[model samples]
Target chain A: MKDTALLSAPLQVQDLTVSYGGDPVLTGADLTVPEGEMTAIIGPNGAGKSTLLKSALGLVKPLSGTITAWDQPLAAQRDRIAYVPQRASVDWDFPTTVLEVALMGLYRQLGLLRRTRPHHRDKALACLDRVGMSDLADRQIGQLSGGQQQRVFLARALAQEAELYLLDEPFAGVDAATEAAIITVLHGLRDAGKTVLCVHHDLSTVPRYFDHVCLLNRHTVAQGPTATTFTDANLMRTYDGRLPTAA
Target chain B: MSEFIALSLPPMLIGTLAAMACALPGNFLLLRRQSLIGDAISHTVLPGIVVAFLLTGSLAALPMMLGAAAAALLAVVLIELIRRFGRVEPGAAMGVVFTTMFAAGVLLLEQTDTASVHLDVEHALYGNLESLIWLDGFVPGALTDPQALATLPPELTRMALTLAVIALALWIFWRPLALATFDNGFAQSLGLPVTTLSLGLVVCAAMAAVAAFDAVGSIIVIAMFICPPASARLMTNDLKHQIAWSLAFAALSATLGYVLAGYGPLWLGAEASVSAAGMIATVSGLILGGTALAGPHRKA
Candidate 1:
């Protein structure tokens, strides 16, 4: 908890709650994402991790409280944040290519009536290259494997060039090699002074990959460095210790 | 044989042109899952035409048509506003806006003897193809050859031009439109004017529906707008491919439906004229049904 006070907060969510059709999914949740680190939100199923991230990005409406990004309201300053929704949320059968989906990250910048400039296209390709997905740029989205689709979404988020990134379950169902590739890219981004918040599973890999961890279950169970807050006690509280607590 | 030619050519040409026009905007709407919005606006345009007629004292093509276009555009804007501010479901918002506008139009038509004035709401629904010949013509002095110079009716011509404009607009803004349709939040984060883009798409769809009203009637125009693109979607997952295939199917359906309307009943030895619009829809439906049935269900 001492490390949490030392880290500079980039996103501050205060008393945020979300509901779908009047059934509350997240209740009175509060957490701060520190600047220039990879923070993994780990919790059991239905822990409201996804809802918290969505609320922080202003994607989901909060019943009460507010989210401030870089000391400003999220709505007034949208360009600073970019969100990568779960791969499952999209209709993969949608009529678009990998490069096109990546290019869509620039839609907020280039706009509706305007065309994607040569520079934008070049940047999109560069982001794809960062994810090692340049070869599949022309392929349609439905033609992609699960890991490949996740990488494409990562490329899209990277293309945003925003100060903060929010990714929902980017590692679900991906292979080891793809995970390594993604982590490598994410680590580089983190080192470059960008904040990356991922709603991650696989608690075993948290100590190796993330510098900070938020153990949440409807509310913040613990928040600190991976070594400090990711102890057996926190694991029990977060996931009820289904696996070995020391993983 | 000549009688067949005489009765069939007008409906064929009109239906083909209208169906083709509707397909252009319908492709995008179907992709966006808002195809039913087209049906709502089409029915809503009747009162607009009636009002336009009341002010002008005749169904003077320009004013009446412009009124219909404006009303349809209003319906789209209202639907958008409700979705944004009311936080209502998009489908429900469309239903509310269109139904209200259409009901208003119906009331106005009934109050005003609009039918005798040639701006009838009934004719707007089941368009009389036989009368289209009397109403149809071309730009008088614009043609080099007297025969090829024949133009469609002023209303249909305007509708065709409006469709061309919408098609051109879609071409110019295809990438943003595609991106927005897929993920609106991403588009907004990138600094795109998402509201404007969405509104523009709805307006374009409304324009297409207005143009389509004179040929196929409002009820069936929905099929023209939804079927080809939906069928095309089943065949491919590329936007360009979908649009191209939809256009091809739309043209093919128009030709087949036109020919069927002319000869299907005669071939069956019945004294009846096949509904060209209905047949066009049926053909497109068959194409979609066949695609759905035969498509590979497992991951390719």
Candidate 2:
């Protein structure tokens, strides 16, 4: 039993039900994300894609569910998880620099009142370099372009040094170069044997970007390898819209 | 020269310290976009002060401060309750809670024989800085003498100690406070005690409000809690620079306001100066307005 549990998927959610103001957003949602793969959670608007990710991260409490990472409770494995929230969730005009936002990822390790040491700064800079944001480290975050801001958030998540990365709409509103840069980083993370789950919107690039796909609409429609599970039927079922002729 | 020093120095020092105390926490409050909480706390603390006086029959600082802190916390709790259970907007909840509390305080004051207590509604709303006199004659050598410390008015000592405590708290909790204010969701996910830290900040703000209540009045405390920090926020995009600028702006407003209140009347041919607390608030507002106008980072 222990061996099988250890070999189970890196993330598992069973019978998850979540609601806001008594309105059910997701019901009976079950998902399993394998390790060492880039998994994209694809769904239509108001389809509970963000809600699923938030509930899995424990940002939003589910009405009923069991979510485990590596068969352990989220509380026990919190440090091993890194989350990048959507851009709209933050106050862009806040008084902080790109470097400062990236450094916030270290706050969990450094704890309260402790200054960031030299090693932490080196690590943060390296993370910035990873996302091509090293040149603009000292610039104020509010002054950055949308893509640059997204890259900064990626840098901050990189600074977390976690084994699992959860991102929400990382490609939304980003330019082509930023999207490619982010995909390269995701591939690097995947090759490193880390799990990456993203709430992605662009359907045309889903197959090229992700190896695993979870199609959802209020609940899981299908979840498996991208080639096997990302079908037109599943897409139509998830989106409730007519399937496109191409791709 | 001696008489002028005796008359002006104590109030100026008091104003500066009070402004500093209020501004320190004001920075965090402004960043959190909860600046109105300061206004709510200042107004709600009035009933606490009145009830403390009625209970103790003496205008002691410590008990009154404790009462005011409790009342401020109660106001926050009430606002939350209204926001949650009543399903009211946060701003509306704050307005409902603070106005009701302030009215209750006024009713309490009218019902009690507070004349013997040396506290009244007017003094609670707008403090009497003119009466804060250093009765003990100043000795030039008293600056360094330990005995001379005892000669200072209790209000000045209280303000000084409050300023020191506020500064120390900011220095010690700077990281957690900043993280929590900047991104509360991230802070919570990191296992930081975000709620406790927020409560601690609110309590500190309440303490500063209570400490300054006797010298600067609730109105000036409210002004100090919003204006200087807001001006500082407009001037900088770095937290450390913002804090330093906030302190500088606060001190400048206090000193400039005192001088303008005391000396500006002479230029207008009036023999006496107006209220120092009112002037301090005015100067702080002017600074905020000016920074909003000229600040490079001011939003379009």
Worst 10 residues of 1 chain A by lDDT: A1-10
Q: Which ranges in model 2 have alpha carbons more than 4 Å from their true place?
A: A1-7, A241-247, B73-88
What does the interface RMSD come to for each candidate?
2.7, 1.4
True C-alpha contacts between chains kept, each model in order:
0.55, 0.59
* Per-residue lDDT of candidate 1, residues A21-68 (tens digit): 567877787787888989999888888998898778766678888788
Q: Considering only N, C-alpha and C atoms within 3 Å, which residue pairs clash in candidate 1?
A: A108-B190, A108-B191, A108-B192, A109-B190, A109-B191, B47-B105, B138-B151
Residue-level lDDT of model 2, residues A78-102, one tens digit each, is: 8998888898778888899998899
DockQ of each: 0.40, 0.66
lDDT by residue for model 1 over B1-300, one digit each (tens)?
Answer: 434333455566667667767787788778677787667667778778777878888655577568887787787799899999999998898888878887787778777775564455665665554455522233233334445445535554665687688888988888777777787665554556667887888777767666666556675577778887877887777788888878887877877876776579999998886666667778878877877777442235
For residues B1-300, what per-residue lDDT tens digits would candidate 2 score against the true structure? 555556777878888989999999999999888888789888999999998888888767788987897787788899999999999898899899999999999888888898864578887877867677664435665555677657777889889998899889888888888888988777766767778999889888988898888788888999999999999989998889988999999999989998898888998999998888888899999999999999877876
| Residue A195 local lDDT, model 1 | 89
Local distance difference test, per candidate? 0.76, 0.87
Strongest candidate by DockQ: 2
